[model samples]
Target: MEWGMHGWGMGLIWVLVVLFLVLGVLAFAKYLIKG
Candidate 1:
């Protein structure tokens, strides 16, 4: 049970990190296009 919870927490963290990175890249691309 403990290991399952730990793995789930790590997965959630990675998902958030990936999502943030994708958003950052999209924003950067938009800025580059506008500039």
Candidate 2:
């Protein structure tokens, strides 16, 4: 179990990816509603 091998940077990247995906879905839903 190496500490820096699976470090906070990688986890932060994944968190951002998920945040973007959630925001994308919300934007699409808003577009559909407006259309």
Candidate 3:
């Protein structure tokens, strides 16, 4: 298990990507509901 700083950064990026995807889905749903 040689995972160091690089692995940590990758994990953080994955979390951020997932967060953005969830936010995008919620925003689209809200737009649909409003329109």
Candidate 4:
């Protein structure tokens, strides 16, 4: 209920957070591979 109060906003934030984390991991892996 508390998380649903903001509806799409909460969902959007979570999607962005997950995307950022995945990108971060990929970037780190890329950097490691390059080095």
Candidate models: Cα lDDT each: 0.96, 0.92, 0.98, 0.93
Per-residue CA lDDT of candidate 3, range 4-32, in tens? 99899999999999999999999999999
What's each prediction's TM-score? 0.89, 0.77, 0.89, 0.78
Q: Name the runs in model 2 displaced over 4 angstroms.
A: none
Q: List RMSD in Å for every model shown.
A: 2.0, 1.7, 1.3, 2.2
Please give the lDDT score for candidate 3: 0.98
Clashes of each: 0, 0, 0, 0
lDDT of 2 by residue, 1-35 (tens): 66684778788889999999999999999999999
lDDT string for model 4 (1-35, tens) is 66565988988989999999999999999999999
Model 4 backbone overlap count:
0
Please write out the lDDT profile of model 1 over residues 1-35, one tens digit for every residue: 47798899999999999999999999999999999
For model 1, the superposed segments whose C-alpha errors exceed 4 Å read none
The worst-scoring run of ten residues by lDDT in candidate 4 lies at 1-10
RMSD of model 4 against the true structure: 2.2
Model 1 whole-model lDDT (C-alpha atoms): 0.96
Query: Best-fitting candidate, measured by lDDT?
Result: 3
